[model samples]
Target: MNVLSENNSITETAILVNPNLGHPRFLEIDQKLKKKKFQTCLLFISDKRDPAYIRDYLNDRIKIVPILDYKWQSQLLLERERKEKKGFLTKVKHFFKRKKKQISELLSQKKIEKTQRRLESLKSRVYRGSPIFPSILEVRSVLTHSIHDLEYINNEYCIPQDYLIKNHAFETLDVFYEIKIEFTLADELLDLFRIRNFIMFDIVQEKNGITERINYHSLVVSKNNWHDFTFVQATDLHLAQRNDRIYGIIKEWMDTFKIENLELIEEAYKKDQKTKKREEQAELFKLPLKRRFVNPNNQFRIFIKLMNRKVFRNELEFVVLSGDLIDFTLLSKLPKDIKKYVDFDYDFSNWKIFKKIVLNFPQKKRRGVIKGEELLCPIFTILGNHDYRPYHYDIRWAGLYRKLGLKLEEALAVNDKLLALPISAIVKSKRALRAYWSQVNPLNDFSIKLGNNNFIFLNTGSDSFKNFLDLITGHPSLTGLTTKQIIYLQNLASHKIQQKKENSFLFLHGPPINPKGKRSFLKRLSKKISGKIITKLDEFKESVIKKIGIKKDTRIDGKFNVKTGTVSTNWSSLIEFCKNYCNLTLAGHTHSLKEFRLDDPKGLKTRVFNAPPFSLKKVENPAAVYYDVYSEIYTSAKDIEKAGPFVVQTPALGLGGYRNPDLAGAYREIVIKEDKLDSFKVKFIDR
Candidate 1:
């Protein structure tokens, strides 16, 4: 049963094995045909219910058949099923029912915040084409920022008194001005407030796409906000799920001969294994990556080299991890109680190892939590569904907070300082992120005042999910809606603006979509909400009324008059949010990493950053987005090889889902000073 080969090429007949379903006849056939001529490409096809076992042992002929598809009968069956479906109403009802099922999910957010979101559908329907907003809202202030001046300026973004009143609601207002505004990222700001119910107002008059920037503004903001930052860090860790044993064998062969040429090396390996019929059978066959992803622990010497470095020694202020920490849970059919069946103790070993490093006190090179006065900060744990959550499972914030909001100051405060914010990340837990956010109670008002600057941190998922859920359900607002109302979830917006002399930085995290002129209405709503906060909520109205060097015929207050302005049918809500104060925006979740530089003609620039995940490639659940992601956390996985007891040497690349219960993946550090970035960095020991 032990077949180990080194760098050998396969070129004969490939014998298919079925140890699980018991194939004694196939084994006999394999034994008899060991010395056959042509190569046999192994074909594994089995019915789920009853396997039609067959093996022609008496007269076997070898021939090459290209596997153009995975199956034939299944495709036919599916086509037949589709053709035999129902009528128009039946299909429509079915679709609505399915969306309703998806929306029935319970939210994982603060009770108050949750309640605010429940009313979103009606809010969106009632307010989509107007400047007037609801009464129970708090507004974020404008950052008299253009891309060229905010980074090094000493201005603070606050809620204008006219906009936000403690515990009071407000509506959207029209604003227009001839001031210099710059390009910006909308996803980043809406993410900052985790805004629930809001609307986007494309102040400009034109047709644009998601990538195109329209100079408009948002009139409302998220009520719940983060504090002047205590400095939160974001970083992504990438990890491989599994490795193939065959690949290991290939690696051994390549290592033995140092084979670099793809063609000649494959030929030589095949020739060397000429006598080994099994090896010859698999010639030129491409193997599945899942089976060949053996963890690179065999290369421990390289890990040692990375561990003894200075960058690994610095402790952090706060850590907000993105997904893909470890591939603990890889669920398929229904999940299993992982810890009950597997040896997960090994998973926590690496966390314990790193914690010791962070805590060390007496040692010159601190190990665990170093006691440096105000240094060793608390770590915030968020879960990727790939970690332990899916097995013990619940819904998450990622599914929530789609795209818009208000509350400029609070949003900026949270984006600048994650730990000081009251939003939840998509960490899986039986208790939910909202429960944790309320329990953590990051700050009294979630605002921190530094010497001259402020920082804030917030994310979507919560508010967006709530409204989306309502929209999905036949709530009053969703009773007679199309897909449009279902997706926007009231509305979502995002923006990032930095003040130079004030030493302030802001970031907002939401589902990632670019500035392609805001194709999706939800995306436009998100951008508009963020833009309104950056510019004064009422400036456009003032400009229109006075017409001080302004156009006489702009849309305003619903009716088209030779007067002010109105909601441009083609303008997106997101572009409406970015018309002012362009700043740095960092976000994750859309599985995209991108950047945007927006500045006035004056050289002001706002940066956008996207954090990547480190989970395994998903292969199951092909009904939807047919790619694989580590699905669940497992205690003991027969198919997966465990590692934590070993070292993970890759720097930015490592598993994201948690294998160890003791700690999450990498920890992020936030460093702040008065002159430059009130920023943080995510770090992991090279090992």
Candidate 2:
């Protein structure tokens, strides 16, 4: 029987496969629901096993129906497999193959300097071992090995060696049958599902393994069946301890670090040495750096107000905070003298402050109603450099060189803290976000399904730096996605694109790819020269001091101080991933708002959007800021929309006094239709 409507005729019946046990209602559905064969869409909603495992298990029962695997594990494993296939040899072949014609053309031109340079480039591409690539290869190798191991163990150990399998013939049971299912969706079904009808169902069973019944829910329409999908993006809140002793201490140190205020710094340092003078030291932390100081309470209110806005409160489904939720970088250990003044028990005051900020955000507000809903939308966040930077100890050059160790466990703790606090709040604040972080990795990378689209969040800060130099001040701090993360995302993208034909977005705290042709040559050159000089000087000092058997007080390492969002290197894998999988990539570390369109040789156009700081006072790269960005950007949407695939840099949300004597504060309202980008506009807010 077909339920006919004017727009869509529900001729095809979707089969909700129960892989665990055959539902008693399955017979009823097959006997009564429709007249034709049960061969359209197969949907499996299982929390116990993965979609792949379920689909593979139920393939025989559901025979001809196309399956949609919503399982996160299957997606990640598939990505890992694809990445492993591209071994070193494959990469080398592809590289040479791609550049073969170019190299031939250059050789024919007979331009010695240019041709020689091209040959050298090819050599480096083949031989130059990047800190990023090997790690990725290792992860791929491990994952591939693990998959193989699992199959081997199940077949060799369980089948022949295990007595249970040999005696009972459990492997031959119908439940263990390998079912055939189409990995790709049929064109007609794809067109039908594109209308955004998600049929949710569950399988129930008795303890004895007898099928009970199948429970089905109404089809979830896409955003009330609206054509326009609206979302708000904010980043880099950098909330820190305010009206506290720690704030004062850090502020005094930050203010005097670069200037000729050594005397005052010395006075404060000595005063902080005395336990009794702690309050006086705290008083010294008083500075007029408004941009850096954001009270969590105030920011929370601002978030509420922003969400309360008619534009957002009405239809805003999700909030994406790219990264840098806090500004406090963890100090490893205080100097001996300073430690004497600080109470050891009070070390976690900063974290306590952050906890309050995150945990207290979801409380029932005094304000009656926010827009039309009492609850805000779901907010998803990734870790920025600042989020975990504080958890790492401040290593003096001598200390760093002596031990080339990674704080793997300690780093995990910090990452957990960062994600857990927000997640806790999300759970408690039931009205706001409806999603859960069930599939998030230890590094806080995960893929979430919303409506018909997939949103993948990456922890770009993880495995970002190879050496201690990257942790140092003024060293190019901008980083790329980890190898494992890249592969996972690539696989997910491929799966969704091939099977579902859905739009996929990648979110990270750091910009994996910078805008094409957006760098200032002279500025870049000057920064490189200065950075090299500083590094060399630090190296010399460490060597000289080590030779003399001196343990110096290198506590004030220059690495502690830095402006965020400076790109030092281009990660080829990230660029390639964008070229392949990402329909839209959003990042927000630079604190500067800008956009660019990536032109790939494969004709894949990925639009990149860099979010502005949610609360940073000054942007890292001031040149990107405009005196009249507000007016200039008023028509950017239409202009950029016309320029094909594009990238957009948004403004910050709080406090701005930069070079141009203009306030930089803005949020973006992005509109997405199906998988293609519809249009976007920067909504500037007064700080």
Best by TM-score: 2
What would the per-residue lDDT of candidate 2 be over residues 1-687, giving only the tens digit for each residue? Answer: 111101111111112221211111111111122322221122222222343455433332321122122221122222333446323233233334556555445434234345333332221110101111000001000011111123422221111112212222122211221222222223433232322222112222111232222211111112233234677776655544421222333344446455555456646555655565444423433433343333333444356345534322235645666666554433233343453343211223243333333323232232211221111233556665655433333222222211111122222322332321322211111111000111110124545454456666766652234322433432234454445555565556544444235555667767643332222354334433223422322332333434545443211112112222433223445555554555556766555655544443333222222222222232222111111122234344344334333334454443222311132345666676644456566665444
Task: Provide the lowest-lDDT 10-residue window in model 2.
Answer: 133-142
Off by over 4 Å in 2: 1-223, 243-297, 310-313, 329-355, 358-375, 391-443, 462-479, 498-501, 515-570, 601-644, 654-665, 673-676
Question: What is the lDDT for 121 in model 2?
Answer: 28
User: TM-scores across all candidates?
Assistant: 0.26, 0.41
TM-score result, candidate 1 = 0.26
Model 1 over residues 609-682: C-alpha lDDT tens digits? 11111222221110100001111221232211221111011112232222111111233334443233333333
Residue 377 in model 2: lDDT: 35
Give each model's whole-structure lDDT. Answer: 0.23, 0.35
Q: What is the lDDT, from 0 to 100, of the residue 118 in candidate 2?
A: 38
The superposed Cα distance between candidate 1 and the true structure at residue 169, in angstroms, equals 30
